[model samples]
Target: MVTFIEKGFLYGFILGLSLGFFIVPYKEVFPMGEGVTETTYLNLVDFIIPLIRVGVITAVIGGLVGFFFYRKKIRAYNNK
Candidate 1:
């Protein structure tokens, strides 16, 4: 089974990307007014770079947290 930290990171990454790519873009999604053009969404490729960076960073941090907790538990068990 995946540890809680791994699960939390996976959920966080998916949730973060979904909101970043979909919900956040709506900030600039105004209707085109007279003689004005609507802002364009970031290109898929452009979004991927930041998306991957966020995902990797989240995963690594989560793994480290999990490792720390695992080590703590091991030490506690050994001391018992």
Candidate 2:
């Protein structure tokens, strides 16, 4: 159970970082509506902040999913 949560966190972190890398490069192509400044450009901090936020959120969701599936498997096995 704990192991699943840990793995979820690790995997989610990696996944988020990968997504950030892919998205940051094409950020300029995505229109942000007028009035935005160049400061909104995909900088290191901007990329990293979303990476961490998404990673943490994904981790929690993943952990819950893992826990649910694990429990389901165990219940099925015991039913036999």
Candidate 3:
């Protein structure tokens, strides 16, 4: 069984990536929509980069919150 803190990080990483994991360039028309046409291309980012960035932020937060809640549960269990 995974610890609550670990599960927190895991769930957070998945949720964060699912939220905004893509970088899609928008089609931009410039110069009063007259001759300049900007081509929009889909940029494929390596899964590692966002995972690391997002994991560092949201996962840590989740782990801390999980730790806090877990401690509360433990205390309740012990008192019972």
Top TM-score model:
2
**Over the stretch 19-60, how does candidate 3's per-residue lDDT look in tens digits?**
535532223344547576666543345555655676568778
Best by lDDT: 2
| Native-to-model Cα distance after best TM-score fit, residue 41 in candidate 1, in Å | 1.2
Could you arrange the candidates by lDDT from highest to lowest? 2, 3, 1
* CA error at residue 39 for candidate 3, angstroms: 4.0
Evaluate all candidate structures by whole-model CA lDDT and list the values in order. 0.65, 0.68, 0.67
Model 2 vs. true fold: TM = 0.63
Backbone clashes in model 3, listed as residue pairs: none
Model 2: which ten-residue window has the lowest total lDDT? Answer: 23-32
- Stretches > 4 Å off in candidate 2: 23-40
Stronger candidate by lDDT (2 vs 3):
2
Please rank every candidate by TM-score, starting with the best.
2, 3, 1
What TM-score does structure 3 among the candidates reach? Answer: 0.62
lDDT of candidate 3 vs native?
0.67
